[model samples]
Target: CKTIFPNLFLIIHRNIVSTVNLACPLDLKSIALQARNAEYNPKVLSYSAVIMRIREPRTTALIFSSGKMVCTGAKSEEQSRLAARKYARVVQKLGFPVKFLDFKIQNMVGSCDVCFPIRLEARAVSWIYRMVKPRIVLLIFVSGKVVLTGTVGI
Candidate 1:
């Protein structure tokens, strides 16, 4: 069966590196001291995570001492993985045994460049997406995107 679909356009994209194992606990103090671009200040409630960024993928990583990491700012899947890997490698080089754990896309939220009015039909996409939290959401570019968290079989 052949079907026609509306042209798709992407204005911006965001991906996350769910989680990774640094293998062992990390000393944020050492990491921050080692890199000029890295920073860590627990003085701030929400700023406890060690912040790190790489220029290549242009992403930021929130590395926790518990060996979990959250990477953001990659425009594509490939770029996201590369960015995460770069973060792990950098930490590994810092004498922390880092391991590339389950690195996968958490969600892909995109907005079209077209200004025309468009309808968002969740039911239509349900068969493929299976589940979309909140059922319906209005995306208004303000630095946040929709998150579809679930496990689907291939």
Candidate 2:
């Protein structure tokens, strides 16, 4: 199912078993929620790492090893970056050993096609093709093989 917040989007996986998935925006409020309710913790939780990606014009995804994630849409690069830093801070304050100063940004791009028409004397003749703007993709992975994907607008 999908949940929409003011600046966050969440996709959750619900099964009556032992696996959960969450994705939300890279905002302070949303990040706090995910960090709190993602998994079962007898003691406090510590964050291993935070990763960021610039995937498109307005989309960012963040994944946590606690089986929590945040996907923020319709944001600028600066907003996304700030949100990420804030999230890392929150995790650290929760007594989790968050090492965010070691984070970095990665860029990704790809191509897409659009269709156009060619006209003849009385009928359409051929189709035309074009390339789409490049997209950026960000990935944050904590320890233990958990991958986080974040994207921000260019």
Candidate 3:
């Protein structure tokens, strides 16, 4: 039987990172509401409800559909990870499970400095690398040695 039905579905998954610095006191609830109603491309099937959470006294979360999330007003990488982990847990608790997409720490201080010291950063980096497990291209900084890890998708 030949039937006319939509067979192809394109799911565009995007994750965005943003930052906000507020000078004066603001209403978090109202701000979140405004973000919730903010428009996006018409091709978007639907905009997911914005999930707002406070990472600390400064940071806030604005989560959207398809695992897209933005952590705003964070000061440090520690703060960013804290917010992202909290948001990820909340999404999981809400029964929306998504594979770890991308973990980024923006607006960070010195390139060498991190929430935790080098050891901890190495461990977390290793863990995330294993989790996402993307193809890695290694470049030797000083010597001519290279280490390649993870599986590449072709």
Candidate 4:
């Protein structure tokens, strides 16, 4: 579900996620051992990160040992922030001095159908010429479906 404003462009669905700094290093395996919802596999990609999930916003947080955490899959910016804070609190309660910092909304994706057919090839060329800024990535389908993603506002 997504919020809609009359003045804004059509948004079918949106994903708003945040990246936060935990301020202290973590022990991935220990976290996995302590938290029932967390899973860590050292054999997977050889990365030291704990995969965590929360059901309220139905998001996933990638908690890394380097004091960095990325939370994804929230439907709105507010939900993303709340979910991130919830995660930080969870970790803090788990005995880590997890201070929520640098909480940045990393990505928001929105899609809509124009209710008309489109020539994707022509649209792609046109969109490229239409001046894309630093962060946005867009995809246009022949069915006039559009997906736009960026770090900026939705």
TM-score of each: 0.68, 0.31, 0.37, 0.84
> Predictions ranked by TM-score, top down?
4, 1, 3, 2
Question: Mind giving the per-residue lDDT tens digits that candidate 3 earns over 24-46?
Answer: 23333333444422333424435
lDDT tens readout by residue for model 2, 1-154: 2223433423221101111132322333334455543233323436532333343333434555553435354233354455555545555555555554433334212222112222334442322233244332322122111111222222
The better candidate by TM-score, 1 or 3, is 1
* C-alpha-based local distance difference test score of model 2: 0.35
Better of 3 and 4 by lDDT: 4
Who wins the TM-score comparison? 4
C-alpha positional error of residue 11 in candidate 4 after TM-score superposition, expressed in Å = 1.4
For 1-154, candidate 1 gives per-residue lDDT tens digits of 1224335433454443445666678888898899767989988747568999899888888988887888877777778888888889888898887888777666554443343333445523212234455442334322222223232111
- lDDT value, residue 104 of candidate 1: 65
lDDT of each: 0.65, 0.35, 0.41, 0.80
Off by over 4 Å in 3: 1-51, 55-57, 108-154
Whose lDDT is higher: candidate 2's or candidate 3's? 3
Residue 137, candidate 2: C-alpha displacement in angstroms: 13
**By descending lDDT, how would the candidates be arranged?**
4, 1, 3, 2
Ranking 2 against 3 by TM-score, winner? 3
* CA RMSD, predictions in order: 7.1, 16.3, 19.6, 4.0
Q: Which stretches of candidate 4 lie over 4 Å from their true place?
A: 1-8, 121-130
The numbered model that scores best in lDDT is 4
